[model samples]
Target: MNYDIFNGDADGIIALLQLRLANPINGELVTGVKRDIQLLEQVQVRPEDRLTVLDISMEKNSAALINALDVGADVFYADHHRCGDITQHQNLQAHIDLDANTCTALIIDQLLEGQFHLWAITAAYGDNLIAKADELATKVNLTKVQAEQLKELGTLINYNGYGSNISDLHFHPADLYRALLNYPNPFDVIIDTNSPFNLLQTAYQQDMDNALAIETKHTSACLSVFELPNTAWARRISGVYGNFLANQQTDSAHAVLTDNNDGTYTVSLRAPLDNKQGAGDVCSQFETGGGRAAAAGINALAKSDLPNFIKSVESHYLV
Candidate 1:
Protein backbone atom coordinates (compact mmCIF):
# COMPACT_ATOMS: atom_id res chain seq x y z
CA MET A 1 0.00 0.00 0.00
CA ASN A 2 1.03 3.62 -0.54
CA TYR A 3 0.34 6.09 2.27
CA ASP A 4 0.21 9.86 1.81
CA ILE A 5 0.51 11.26 5.33
CA PHE A 6 0.47 15.01 5.88
CA ASN A 7 -0.66 17.65 8.31
CA GLY A 8 -4.12 18.97 7.55
CA ASP A 9 -2.94 22.59 7.23
CA ALA A 10 -2.44 24.55 4.03
CA ASP A 11 1.31 23.95 3.85
CA GLY A 12 0.98 20.18 4.06
CA ILE A 13 -1.94 19.98 1.65
CA ILE A 14 -0.35 22.29 -0.90
CA ALA A 15 3.03 20.60 -0.61
CA LEU A 16 1.53 17.22 -1.40
CA LEU A 17 -0.67 18.79 -4.06
CA GLN A 18 2.38 20.11 -5.89
CA LEU A 19 4.12 16.73 -5.85
CA ARG A 20 1.09 14.77 -6.99
CA LEU A 21 0.31 17.30 -9.66
CA ALA A 22 3.82 16.85 -10.97
CA ASN A 23 3.78 13.07 -10.66
CA PRO A 24 0.39 11.49 -10.11
CA ILE A 25 0.04 8.98 -7.28
CA ASN A 26 -2.77 6.85 -5.85
CA GLY A 27 -2.12 6.59 -2.14
CA GLU A 28 -4.09 6.23 1.08
CA LEU A 29 -4.57 9.73 2.48
CA VAL A 30 -3.66 9.86 6.20
CA THR A 31 -4.32 13.13 7.95
CA GLY A 32 -6.29 14.58 10.85
CA VAL A 33 -6.79 17.86 12.72
CA LYS A 34 -3.84 20.27 12.49
CA ARG A 35 -2.64 19.45 16.01
CA ASP A 36 -2.48 15.73 15.29
CA ILE A 37 1.22 15.63 14.41
CA GLN A 38 2.03 12.13 15.61
CA LEU A 39 0.63 10.60 12.46
CA LEU A 40 3.27 8.04 11.44
CA GLU A 41 2.41 5.63 14.28
CA GLN A 42 -1.12 5.32 12.98
CA VAL A 43 -0.02 3.43 9.91
CA GLN A 44 1.03 -0.21 9.97
CA VAL A 45 4.00 -0.25 7.63
CA ARG A 46 5.19 -3.25 5.62
CA PRO A 47 8.29 -3.94 3.59
CA GLU A 48 6.50 -3.33 0.32
CA ASP A 49 4.74 -0.17 1.40
CA ARG A 50 5.56 3.35 0.23
CA LEU A 51 4.98 6.43 2.39
CA THR A 52 5.06 10.16 1.75
CA VAL A 53 5.10 12.33 4.87
CA LEU A 54 4.71 16.10 4.74
CA ASP A 55 4.70 19.14 7.09
CA ILE A 56 4.38 17.23 10.41
CA SER A 57 7.45 17.20 12.61
CA MET A 58 9.88 14.31 12.17
CA GLU A 59 10.78 14.47 15.86
CA LYS A 60 7.22 13.71 16.91
CA ASN A 61 7.06 10.77 14.52
CA SER A 62 10.64 9.56 14.87
CA ALA A 63 9.89 6.17 16.35
CA ALA A 64 7.23 5.30 13.82
CA LEU A 65 9.41 6.62 11.01
CA ILE A 66 12.35 4.50 12.12
CA ASN A 67 10.11 1.48 12.33
CA ALA A 68 8.85 2.11 8.80
CA LEU A 69 12.42 2.34 7.53
CA ASP A 70 13.50 -0.75 9.44
CA VAL A 71 10.64 -2.66 7.87
CA GLY A 72 12.05 -1.67 4.45
CA ALA A 73 9.40 0.87 3.52
CA ASP A 74 10.35 3.62 1.11
CA VAL A 75 9.68 6.95 2.87
CA PHE A 76 9.82 10.46 1.47
CA TYR A 77 9.46 13.13 4.19
CA ALA A 78 9.38 16.90 3.81
CA ASP A 79 8.75 19.55 6.45
CA HIS A 80 9.77 22.94 7.93
CA HIS A 81 9.14 22.07 11.59
CA ARG A 82 11.55 21.16 14.41
CA CYS A 83 12.96 17.74 13.60
CA GLY A 84 14.94 16.44 16.56
CA ASP A 85 17.41 14.17 14.77
CA ILE A 86 17.12 12.78 11.31
CA THR A 87 17.75 9.07 10.82
CA GLN A 88 20.09 7.90 8.11
CA HIS A 89 18.56 5.12 6.03
CA GLN A 90 18.63 4.33 2.35
CA ASN A 91 14.85 3.94 2.31
CA LEU A 92 14.34 7.39 3.84
CA GLN A 93 14.47 10.58 1.80
CA ALA A 94 13.97 13.63 4.04
CA HIS A 95 13.76 17.30 3.08
CA ILE A 96 13.61 19.60 6.12
CA ASP A 97 14.15 23.38 6.29
CA LEU A 98 13.87 25.11 9.69
CA ASP A 99 14.07 28.67 8.36
CA ALA A 100 11.40 30.90 9.89
CA ASN A 101 10.70 32.54 6.53
CA THR A 102 10.11 29.28 4.65
CA CYS A 103 7.50 26.49 4.71
CA THR A 104 7.10 22.93 3.41
CA ALA A 105 5.32 24.06 0.25
CA LEU A 106 8.14 26.45 -0.54
CA ILE A 107 10.68 23.68 -0.03
CA ILE A 108 8.72 21.44 -2.40
CA ASP A 109 8.59 24.32 -4.85
CA GLN A 110 12.37 24.28 -5.01
CA LEU A 111 12.35 20.54 -5.63
CA LEU A 112 9.80 20.91 -8.40
CA GLU A 113 11.65 23.95 -9.82
CA GLY A 114 8.57 26.16 -9.45
CA GLN A 115 6.18 24.07 -11.50
CA PHE A 116 3.50 25.07 -9.01
CA HIS A 117 5.08 28.30 -7.80
CA LEU A 118 1.84 30.18 -7.25
CA TRP A 119 0.42 27.39 -5.10
CA ALA A 120 3.63 27.43 -3.05
CA ILE A 121 3.29 31.19 -2.49
CA THR A 122 -0.28 30.64 -1.32
CA ALA A 123 0.94 28.06 1.16
CA ALA A 124 3.61 30.46 2.38
CA TYR A 125 0.90 33.05 3.02
CA GLY A 126 -1.25 30.49 4.77
CA ASP A 127 1.69 29.49 6.94
CA ASN A 128 1.87 33.17 7.98
CA LEU A 129 5.17 33.89 6.20
CA ILE A 130 3.58 37.08 4.94
CA ALA A 131 6.71 38.99 3.98
CA LYS A 132 8.19 35.98 2.22
CA ALA A 133 4.99 35.31 0.31
CA ASP A 134 4.74 38.95 -0.70
CA GLU A 135 8.29 38.86 -2.05
CA LEU A 136 7.58 35.70 -4.04
CA ALA A 137 4.31 37.10 -5.38
CA THR A 138 6.06 40.19 -6.60
CA LYS A 139 8.84 38.14 -8.22
CA VAL A 140 6.15 36.33 -10.18
CA ASN A 141 4.69 39.68 -11.29
CA LEU A 142 1.28 39.00 -9.71
CA THR A 143 -0.86 42.13 -9.60
CA LYS A 144 -1.77 43.62 -6.19
CA VAL A 145 -5.35 42.33 -6.41
CA GLN A 146 -4.14 38.90 -7.50
CA ALA A 147 -1.73 38.73 -4.58
CA GLU A 148 -4.46 39.69 -2.12
CA GLN A 149 -6.81 37.09 -3.59
CA LEU A 150 -4.24 34.34 -3.07
CA LYS A 151 -3.51 35.56 0.45
CA GLU A 152 -7.18 35.42 1.42
CA LEU A 153 -7.54 31.96 -0.11
CA GLY A 154 -4.50 30.74 1.79
CA THR A 155 -5.66 32.25 5.08
CA LEU A 156 -9.16 30.77 4.78
CA ILE A 157 -7.80 27.32 4.00
CA ASN A 158 -5.46 27.55 6.97
CA TYR A 159 -8.28 28.75 9.24
CA ASN A 160 -10.29 25.66 8.32
CA GLY A 161 -7.52 23.46 9.78
CA TYR A 162 -7.56 24.88 13.34
CA GLY A 163 -10.43 22.92 14.88
CA SER A 164 -10.29 20.61 17.90
CA ASN A 165 -11.25 17.71 15.67
CA ILE A 166 -12.53 16.90 12.20
CA SER A 167 -16.08 17.48 13.45
CA ASP A 168 -15.27 21.10 14.20
CA LEU A 169 -13.74 21.72 10.78
CA HIS A 170 -15.84 22.85 7.80
CA PHE A 171 -14.14 20.23 5.63
CA HIS A 172 -12.04 17.24 6.58
CA PRO A 173 -8.42 17.72 5.42
CA ALA A 174 -8.52 14.73 3.08
CA ASP A 175 -11.73 15.92 1.50
CA LEU A 176 -10.28 19.40 1.23
CA TYR A 177 -7.15 18.01 -0.45
CA ARG A 178 -9.24 16.06 -2.92
CA ALA A 179 -11.31 19.11 -3.72
CA LEU A 180 -8.19 21.19 -4.30
CA LEU A 181 -6.73 18.63 -6.70
CA ASN A 182 -9.30 19.71 -9.26
CA TYR A 183 -7.66 23.13 -9.54
CA PRO A 184 -4.00 23.23 -10.57
CA ASN A 185 -4.06 27.01 -10.24
CA PRO A 186 -5.22 28.41 -6.89
CA PHE A 187 -6.83 31.40 -8.61
CA ASP A 188 -9.24 28.97 -10.21
CA VAL A 189 -10.60 28.03 -6.80
CA ILE A 190 -11.05 31.70 -5.95
CA ILE A 191 -12.89 32.45 -9.21
CA ASP A 192 -15.09 29.37 -9.08
CA THR A 193 -18.50 30.38 -7.72
CA ASN A 194 -18.88 27.05 -5.93
CA SER A 195 -15.58 26.14 -4.30
CA PRO A 196 -14.23 25.48 -0.84
CA PHE A 197 -12.62 28.92 -0.99
CA ASN A 198 -16.00 30.67 -0.89
CA LEU A 199 -17.33 28.39 1.84
CA LEU A 200 -14.23 28.83 3.98
CA GLN A 201 -14.09 32.59 3.34
CA THR A 202 -17.57 33.03 4.78
CA ALA A 203 -16.85 30.75 7.75
CA TYR A 204 -13.49 32.41 8.48
CA GLN A 205 -15.00 35.90 8.54
CA GLN A 206 -17.69 34.84 11.00
CA ASP A 207 -15.27 33.07 13.35
CA MET A 208 -12.71 35.86 13.18
CA ASP A 209 -15.42 38.44 13.91
CA ASN A 210 -16.30 36.59 17.11
CA ALA A 211 -12.64 36.38 18.12
CA LEU A 212 -12.01 40.07 17.41
CA ALA A 213 -14.76 41.04 19.87
CA ILE A 214 -12.99 39.35 22.82
CA GLU A 215 -10.81 41.54 25.04
CA THR A 216 -7.24 40.58 25.82
CA LYS A 217 -6.62 38.60 28.98
CA HIS A 218 -3.10 39.98 29.30
CA THR A 219 -1.07 42.51 27.32
CA SER A 220 2.41 43.95 27.57
CA ALA A 221 5.16 45.33 25.40
CA CYS A 222 6.59 41.88 24.78
CA LEU A 223 3.56 39.65 24.79
CA SER A 224 -0.25 39.63 24.60
CA VAL A 225 -2.56 36.83 25.63
CA PHE A 226 -6.23 36.18 24.88
CA GLU A 227 -8.55 33.59 26.37
CA LEU A 228 -11.28 32.12 24.21
CA PRO A 229 -14.41 30.31 25.34
CA ASN A 230 -14.81 26.56 25.01
CA THR A 231 -16.80 26.52 21.81
CA ALA A 232 -16.48 25.25 18.24
CA TRP A 233 -15.93 28.77 17.01
CA ALA A 234 -13.05 29.34 19.39
CA ARG A 235 -11.42 26.05 18.47
CA ARG A 236 -11.76 26.85 14.77
CA ILE A 237 -10.36 30.35 15.12
CA SER A 238 -7.61 30.03 17.72
CA GLY A 239 -4.59 29.30 15.49
CA VAL A 240 -5.44 31.72 12.72
CA TYR A 241 -6.42 34.27 15.35
CA GLY A 242 -2.95 33.95 16.83
CA ASN A 243 -1.52 34.70 13.39
CA PHE A 244 -3.80 37.71 13.10
CA LEU A 245 -2.63 39.04 16.44
CA ALA A 246 1.01 38.44 15.61
CA ASN A 247 0.64 40.32 12.34
CA GLN A 248 -0.93 43.28 14.12
CA GLN A 249 2.09 43.79 16.37
CA THR A 250 5.25 42.60 14.65
CA ASP A 251 7.34 43.25 17.75
CA SER A 252 5.10 41.52 20.30
CA ALA A 253 4.41 37.82 20.66
CA HIS A 254 0.77 36.61 20.92
CA ALA A 255 -0.94 33.71 22.59
CA VAL A 256 -4.49 32.47 22.01
CA LEU A 257 -5.72 30.05 24.62
CA THR A 258 -8.97 28.23 23.93
CA ASP A 259 -10.75 26.60 26.83
CA ASN A 260 -10.69 22.86 26.31
CA ASN A 261 -13.41 22.48 28.98
CA ASP A 262 -11.50 19.73 30.72
CA GLY A 263 -9.55 21.70 33.25
CA THR A 264 -7.16 22.48 30.41
CA TYR A 265 -6.64 24.85 27.53
CA THR A 266 -5.41 24.54 23.95
CA VAL A 267 -2.64 27.08 23.37
CA SER A 268 -1.52 28.61 20.11
CA LEU A 269 1.66 30.67 20.33
CA ARG A 270 3.27 32.92 17.74
CA ALA A 271 6.64 34.63 18.02
CA PRO A 272 7.12 38.26 17.09
CA LEU A 273 7.17 38.72 13.34
CA ASP A 274 10.29 40.84 13.59
CA ASN A 275 12.09 38.11 15.56
CA LYS A 276 10.70 34.80 14.46
CA GLN A 277 12.21 32.59 17.11
CA GLY A 278 11.52 31.02 20.54
CA ALA A 279 7.82 30.16 20.13
CA GLY A 280 8.55 26.44 19.76
CA ASP A 281 11.13 26.63 22.52
CA VAL A 282 8.70 28.29 24.91
CA CYS A 283 5.82 25.95 24.10
CA SER A 284 8.10 22.92 24.35
CA GLN A 285 8.72 23.72 28.03
CA PHE A 286 5.18 22.51 28.70
CA GLU A 287 3.82 19.04 28.16
CA THR A 288 1.95 18.23 24.92
CA GLY A 289 3.63 21.10 23.14
CA GLY A 290 5.98 21.38 20.17
CA GLY A 291 6.27 23.07 16.76
CA ARG A 292 8.30 25.35 14.49
CA ALA A 293 10.16 28.39 15.76
CA ALA A 294 7.79 31.09 14.57
CA ALA A 295 4.62 29.18 15.51
CA ALA A 296 4.03 26.36 17.98
CA GLY A 297 1.16 24.94 20.01
CA ILE A 298 0.19 22.93 23.05
CA ASN A 299 -2.62 20.46 22.56
CA ALA A 300 -3.89 20.54 26.16
CA LEU A 301 -2.37 22.75 28.84
CA ALA A 302 -3.56 22.67 32.41
CA LYS A 303 -5.58 25.76 33.21
CA SER A 304 -3.46 26.34 36.33
CA ASP A 305 -0.31 26.74 34.23
CA LEU A 306 -1.72 29.67 32.32
CA PRO A 307 0.36 32.20 34.25
CA ASN A 308 3.58 30.29 33.72
CA PHE A 309 2.75 29.99 30.03
CA ILE A 310 2.38 33.73 29.76
CA LYS A 311 5.60 34.26 31.70
CA SER A 312 7.41 31.91 29.38
CA VAL A 313 6.21 33.82 26.33
CA GLU A 314 7.11 37.14 27.93
CA SER A 315 10.58 36.04 28.94
CA HIS A 316 11.38 34.55 25.55
CA TYR A 317 10.35 37.56 23.53
CA LEU A 318 11.63 40.07 26.10
CA VAL A 319 15.10 38.73 25.46
Candidate 2:
Protein backbone atom coordinates (compact mmCIF):
# COMPACT_ATOMS: atom_id res chain seq x y z
CA MET A 1 0.00 0.00 0.00
CA ASN A 2 1.07 3.58 -0.60
CA TYR A 3 1.19 5.89 2.43
CA ASP A 4 1.23 9.67 2.17
CA ILE A 5 2.26 11.09 5.55
CA PHE A 6 2.74 14.84 5.84
CA ASN A 7 2.44 17.71 8.24
CA GLY A 8 -1.04 19.15 8.07
CA ASP A 9 0.25 22.69 7.53
CA ALA A 10 0.31 24.50 4.19
CA ASP A 11 3.91 23.67 3.38
CA GLY A 12 3.35 19.96 4.02
CA ILE A 13 -0.06 19.74 2.40
CA ILE A 14 0.91 21.75 -0.68
CA ALA A 15 4.20 19.93 -1.02
CA LEU A 16 2.37 16.61 -1.29
CA LEU A 17 -0.32 18.22 -3.42
CA GLN A 18 2.24 19.31 -6.02
CA LEU A 19 3.92 15.89 -5.96
CA ARG A 20 0.68 13.93 -6.31
CA LEU A 21 -0.55 16.24 -9.01
CA ALA A 22 2.64 15.55 -10.95
CA ASN A 23 2.66 11.81 -10.15
CA PRO A 24 -0.72 10.49 -9.21
CA ILE A 25 -0.96 8.15 -6.19
CA ASN A 26 -3.74 6.55 -4.20
CA GLY A 27 -2.04 6.62 -0.80
CA GLU A 28 -3.38 6.34 2.71
CA LEU A 29 -3.28 9.89 4.10
CA VAL A 30 -1.85 10.34 7.60
CA THR A 31 -1.76 13.76 9.22
CA GLY A 32 -2.88 15.71 12.23
CA VAL A 33 -2.58 19.29 13.55
CA LYS A 34 0.30 21.48 12.41
CA ARG A 35 2.24 20.69 15.58
CA ASP A 36 1.93 16.94 15.08
CA ILE A 37 5.15 16.23 13.18
CA GLN A 38 6.09 12.77 14.43
CA LEU A 39 3.92 11.17 11.76
CA LEU A 40 6.05 8.35 10.42
CA GLU A 41 5.59 6.19 13.51
CA GLN A 42 1.87 5.91 12.91
CA VAL A 43 2.27 3.98 9.69
CA GLN A 44 2.89 0.23 9.77
CA VAL A 45 5.26 -0.12 6.88
CA ARG A 46 5.67 -3.47 5.17
CA PRO A 47 7.98 -4.58 2.43
CA GLU A 48 7.27 -2.77 -0.86
CA ASP A 49 5.05 -0.12 0.80
CA ARG A 50 5.62 3.30 -0.68
CA LEU A 51 5.69 6.34 1.62
CA THR A 52 5.82 9.99 0.71
CA VAL A 53 6.66 12.11 3.76
CA LEU A 54 6.88 15.89 3.74
CA ASP A 55 7.43 18.96 5.96
CA ILE A 56 8.05 16.87 9.12
CA SER A 57 11.30 16.78 11.01
CA MET A 58 13.32 13.67 10.27
CA GLU A 59 15.20 13.76 13.56
CA LYS A 60 12.03 13.06 15.48
CA ASN A 61 11.03 10.26 13.17
CA SER A 62 14.43 8.75 12.53
CA ALA A 63 13.75 5.41 14.16
CA ALA A 64 10.53 4.91 12.29
CA LEU A 65 12.23 5.86 9.04
CA ILE A 66 15.00 3.37 9.69
CA ASN A 67 12.41 0.73 10.40
CA ALA A 68 10.58 1.51 7.17
CA LEU A 69 13.79 1.34 5.15
CA ASP A 70 14.89 -1.86 6.85
CA VAL A 71 11.58 -3.40 5.94
CA GLY A 72 12.34 -2.62 2.27
CA ALA A 73 9.72 0.11 1.96
CA ASP A 74 10.47 2.94 -0.45
CA VAL A 75 10.42 6.38 1.19
CA PHE A 76 10.52 9.81 -0.40
CA TYR A 77 11.00 12.50 2.25
CA ALA A 78 11.11 16.27 1.86
CA ASP A 79 11.31 18.90 4.56
CA HIS A 80 12.89 22.17 5.74
CA HIS A 81 12.96 21.39 9.45
CA ARG A 82 15.86 20.25 11.64
CA CYS A 83 17.03 16.82 10.53
CA GLY A 84 19.48 15.36 13.02
CA ASP A 85 21.50 12.57 11.43
CA ILE A 86 19.91 11.20 8.29
CA THR A 87 20.13 7.46 7.79
CA GLN A 88 21.64 6.51 4.44
CA HIS A 89 19.60 3.73 2.90
CA GLN A 90 19.12 2.59 -0.68
CA ASN A 91 15.36 2.64 -0.14
CA LEU A 92 15.24 6.30 0.88
CA GLN A 93 15.05 9.37 -1.34
CA ALA A 94 15.31 12.49 0.81
CA HIS A 95 15.13 16.14 -0.21
CA ILE A 96 15.89 18.32 2.78
CA ASP A 97 16.78 22.03 2.69
CA LEU A 98 17.27 23.69 6.08
CA ASP A 99 17.45 27.24 4.74
CA ALA A 100 15.10 29.53 6.62
CA ASN A 101 13.93 31.11 3.37
CA THR A 102 12.84 27.82 1.73
CA CYS A 103 9.98 25.42 2.50
CA THR A 104 9.12 21.91 1.35
CA ALA A 105 6.69 23.10 -1.32
CA LEU A 106 9.36 25.35 -2.81
CA ILE A 107 11.79 22.42 -2.80
CA ILE A 108 9.16 20.36 -4.64
CA ASP A 109 8.64 23.32 -6.98
CA GLN A 110 12.26 23.01 -8.03
CA LEU A 111 11.87 19.26 -8.50
CA LEU A 112 8.66 19.65 -10.52
CA GLU A 113 10.30 22.51 -12.46
CA GLY A 114 7.55 24.87 -11.36
CA GLN A 115 4.65 23.16 -13.10
CA PHE A 116 2.58 24.24 -10.10
CA HIS A 117 4.53 27.38 -9.33
CA LEU A 118 1.49 29.33 -8.25
CA TRP A 119 0.56 26.78 -5.59
CA ALA A 120 4.16 26.76 -4.39
CA ILE A 121 4.04 30.52 -4.04
CA THR A 122 0.85 30.22 -2.03
CA ALA A 123 2.48 27.66 0.25
CA ALA A 124 5.37 30.03 0.79
CA TYR A 125 2.94 32.75 1.78
CA GLY A 126 1.09 30.41 4.11
CA ASP A 127 4.39 29.41 5.69
CA ASN A 128 4.99 33.14 6.34
CA LEU A 129 7.87 33.49 3.96
CA ILE A 130 6.08 36.61 2.77
CA ALA A 131 9.00 38.51 1.25
CA LYS A 132 10.24 35.43 -0.61
CA ALA A 133 6.79 34.62 -1.93
CA ASP A 134 6.31 38.19 -3.09
CA GLU A 135 9.63 38.09 -4.90
CA LEU A 136 8.60 34.90 -6.70
CA ALA A 137 5.21 36.35 -7.54
CA THR A 138 6.79 39.44 -9.09
CA LYS A 139 9.18 37.28 -11.09
CA VAL A 140 6.18 35.47 -12.51
CA ASN A 141 4.60 38.84 -13.45
CA LEU A 142 1.70 38.49 -11.06
CA THR A 143 -0.10 41.76 -10.39
CA LYS A 144 -0.31 43.17 -6.86
CA VAL A 145 -3.97 42.16 -6.61
CA GLN A 146 -3.24 38.66 -7.83
CA ALA A 147 -0.41 38.24 -5.35
CA GLU A 148 -2.61 39.41 -2.50
CA GLN A 149 -5.27 36.86 -3.46
CA LEU A 150 -2.74 34.05 -3.23
CA LYS A 151 -1.38 35.39 0.05
CA GLU A 152 -4.83 35.54 1.60
CA LEU A 153 -5.68 32.06 0.40
CA GLY A 154 -2.38 30.75 1.69
CA THR A 155 -2.81 32.43 5.05
CA LEU A 156 -6.31 31.03 5.45
CA ILE A 157 -5.22 27.52 4.59
CA ASN A 158 -2.43 27.89 7.11
CA TYR A 159 -4.87 29.22 9.68
CA ASN A 160 -6.91 26.07 9.31
CA GLY A 161 -3.93 23.94 10.40
CA TYR A 162 -3.38 25.56 13.79
CA GLY A 163 -5.69 23.86 16.29
CA SER A 164 -4.43 21.83 19.22
CA ASN A 165 -5.92 18.86 17.41
CA ILE A 166 -8.11 18.11 14.39
CA SER A 167 -11.22 18.76 16.47
CA ASP A 168 -10.36 22.45 16.80
CA LEU A 169 -9.64 22.80 13.11
CA HIS A 170 -12.35 23.89 10.71
CA PHE A 171 -11.43 21.14 8.23
CA HIS A 172 -9.40 18.02 8.81
CA PRO A 173 -6.18 18.49 6.83
CA ALA A 174 -6.86 15.29 4.86
CA ASP A 175 -10.26 16.53 3.77
CA LEU A 176 -8.78 19.91 2.93
CA TYR A 177 -6.10 18.25 0.82
CA ARG A 178 -8.69 16.16 -1.04
CA ALA A 179 -10.84 19.22 -1.66
CA LEU A 180 -7.83 21.12 -2.97
CA LEU A 181 -6.70 18.24 -5.21
CA ASN A 182 -9.73 18.91 -7.42
CA TYR A 183 -8.19 22.26 -8.38
CA PRO A 184 -4.74 21.92 -9.85
CA ASN A 185 -4.53 25.69 -10.01
CA PRO A 186 -4.92 27.56 -6.71
CA PHE A 187 -6.62 30.50 -8.40
CA ASP A 188 -9.54 28.28 -9.27
CA VAL A 189 -10.08 27.61 -5.57
CA ILE A 190 -10.01 31.34 -4.86
CA ILE A 191 -12.58 31.98 -7.59
CA ASP A 192 -14.81 29.11 -6.59
CA THR A 193 -17.46 30.55 -4.23
CA ASN A 194 -17.96 27.18 -2.54
CA SER A 195 -14.28 26.60 -1.85
CA PRO A 196 -12.75 25.96 1.59
CA PHE A 197 -11.09 29.34 1.25
CA ASN A 198 -14.37 31.14 1.90
CA LEU A 199 -15.14 29.14 5.03
CA LEU A 200 -11.61 29.51 6.38
CA GLN A 201 -11.53 33.25 5.62
CA THR A 202 -14.60 33.94 7.70
CA ALA A 203 -13.42 31.72 10.54
CA TYR A 204 -9.94 33.25 10.44
CA GLN A 205 -11.21 36.81 10.74
CA GLN A 206 -13.38 35.97 13.72
CA ASP A 207 -10.63 34.15 15.63
CA MET A 208 -8.08 36.82 14.78
CA ASP A 209 -10.39 39.50 16.08
CA ASN A 210 -10.58 37.69 19.39
CA ALA A 211 -6.82 37.28 19.55
CA LEU A 212 -6.20 40.95 18.72
CA ALA A 213 -8.26 42.04 21.68
CA ILE A 214 -5.98 40.20 24.12
CA GLU A 215 -3.13 42.22 25.61
CA THR A 216 0.46 41.12 25.41
CA LYS A 217 1.72 39.15 28.38
CA HIS A 218 5.17 40.64 28.04
CA THR A 219 7.03 42.93 25.63
CA SER A 220 10.59 44.19 25.31
CA ALA A 221 12.99 45.44 22.69
CA CYS A 222 14.02 41.92 21.72
CA LEU A 223 10.86 39.94 22.37
CA SER A 224 7.11 40.11 22.94
CA VAL A 225 4.83 37.43 24.35
CA PHE A 226 1.08 36.90 24.29
CA GLU A 227 -0.70 34.30 26.40
CA LEU A 228 -4.03 33.05 25.09
CA PRO A 229 -6.84 31.32 26.97
CA ASN A 230 -7.59 27.62 26.73
CA THR A 231 -10.36 27.81 24.19
CA ALA A 232 -10.90 26.51 20.70
CA TRP A 233 -10.43 29.96 19.18
CA ALA A 234 -7.21 30.52 21.05
CA ARG A 235 -5.78 27.16 19.98
CA ARG A 236 -7.01 27.65 16.43
CA ILE A 237 -5.46 31.11 16.13
CA SER A 238 -2.14 30.74 17.95
CA GLY A 239 0.30 29.87 15.15
CA VAL A 240 -0.97 32.33 12.53
CA TYR A 241 -1.31 34.93 15.27
CA GLY A 242 2.39 34.51 15.96
CA ASN A 243 3.09 35.15 12.27
CA PHE A 244 0.91 38.26 12.37
CA LEU A 245 2.80 39.49 15.40
CA ALA A 246 6.16 38.81 13.76
CA ASN A 247 5.12 40.76 10.65
CA GLN A 248 3.96 43.65 12.79
CA GLN A 249 7.41 44.00 14.33
CA THR A 250 10.11 42.59 12.15
CA ASP A 251 13.01 43.34 14.51
CA SER A 252 11.51 41.59 17.52
CA ALA A 253 10.84 37.90 18.12
CA HIS A 254 7.29 36.94 19.04
CA ALA A 255 5.76 34.15 21.09
CA VAL A 256 2.10 33.19 21.18
CA LEU A 257 1.34 30.89 24.11
CA THR A 258 -2.03 29.23 24.42
CA ASP A 259 -3.19 27.62 27.64
CA ASN A 260 -3.42 23.87 27.02
CA ASN A 261 -5.56 23.60 30.17
CA ASP A 262 -3.30 20.94 31.56
CA GLY A 263 -0.94 23.23 33.41
CA THR A 264 0.88 23.61 30.13
CA TYR A 265 0.99 26.04 27.26
CA THR A 266 1.27 25.41 23.55
CA VAL A 267 4.00 27.72 22.33
CA SER A 268 4.56 29.18 18.88
CA LEU A 269 7.81 31.08 18.55
CA ARG A 270 8.97 33.19 15.62
CA ALA A 271 12.47 34.52 15.23
CA PRO A 272 12.94 38.18 14.34
CA LEU A 273 12.27 38.67 10.66
CA ASP A 274 15.56 40.55 10.33
CA ASN A 275 17.45 37.59 11.82
CA LYS A 276 15.61 34.40 10.97
CA GLN A 277 17.76 32.08 12.99
CA GLY A 278 17.66 30.38 16.43
CA ALA A 279 13.89 29.84 16.79
CA GLY A 280 14.18 26.10 16.39
CA ASP A 281 17.25 26.08 18.55
CA VAL A 282 15.53 27.89 21.38
CA CYS A 283 12.39 25.80 21.18
CA SER A 284 14.44 22.63 20.98
CA GLN A 285 15.90 23.52 24.34
CA PHE A 286 12.62 22.42 25.79
CA GLU A 287 10.85 19.09 25.65
CA THR A 288 8.16 18.53 23.03
CA GLY A 289 9.54 21.45 21.01
CA GLY A 290 11.09 21.45 17.56
CA GLY A 291 10.66 23.12 14.15
CA ARG A 292 12.41 25.24 11.50
CA ALA A 293 14.79 28.04 12.40
CA ALA A 294 12.48 30.82 11.29
CA ALA A 295 9.51 29.22 13.03
CA ALA A 296 9.33 26.59 15.77
CA GLY A 297 6.91 25.45 18.42
CA ILE A 298 6.53 23.65 21.74
CA ASN A 299 3.57 21.30 21.88
CA ALA A 300 3.19 21.59 25.64
CA LEU A 301 5.19 23.81 27.97
CA ALA A 302 4.79 23.83 31.68
CA LYS A 303 3.87 27.12 33.35
CA SER A 304 6.97 26.81 35.51
CA ASP A 305 9.15 26.78 32.43
CA LEU A 306 7.48 29.85 30.94
CA PRO A 307 10.03 32.19 32.44
CA ASN A 308 12.89 30.10 31.14
CA PHE A 309 11.31 30.00 27.68
CA ILE A 310 11.07 33.79 27.62
CA LYS A 311 14.61 34.14 28.89
CA SER A 312 15.84 31.79 26.20
CA VAL A 313 14.16 33.77 23.45
CA GLU A 314 15.42 37.06 24.82
CA SER A 315 18.97 35.83 25.24
CA HIS A 316 19.11 34.49 21.67
CA TYR A 317 17.66 37.57 20.02
CA LEU A 318 19.19 40.15 22.37
CA VAL A 319 22.56 39.42 20.85
Q: In angstroms, how far off is 300's CA in candidate 2?
A: 0.9
Compute each candidate's TM-score over C-alphas. 0.99, 0.99
Q: Give every collision pair in model 1.
A: none
> Taking the tens digit of each residue's C-alpha lDDT, what string does model 1 give over 1-319?
9999999999999999999999999999999999999999999999979999999999999999999999989999999999998999999999999999999999999999999999999999999999999999999999999999999988988888888889999999999999999999999999998889888988999999999999999998899989999999999999999999999999999999999999999999999999999889899999999999999999999999998998888877786
Angstrom error at residue 39, model 2 = 0.7
Q: For candidate 2, write residues 1-319 as lDDT tens digits.
A: 9999999989989999999999998979999999888899999899999999999999999999999999999999999999999889998999999999999999999999999999999999999999999999999999999999999989998899998878999999999999999999999999999999889989999999999999989998899999999999999999999999999999999999999889999999999999999999999999999998999999999999999999999999996
TM-score of 1: 0.99
Top-lDDT candidate index: 2
Candidate 1 regions off by >4 Å?
Answer: none
Worst ten in a row by lDDT for model 1: 310-319
- The local distance difference test score of each candidate is 0.94, 0.95
Q: Give residue 8's error in model 2 in angstroms.
A: 0.4
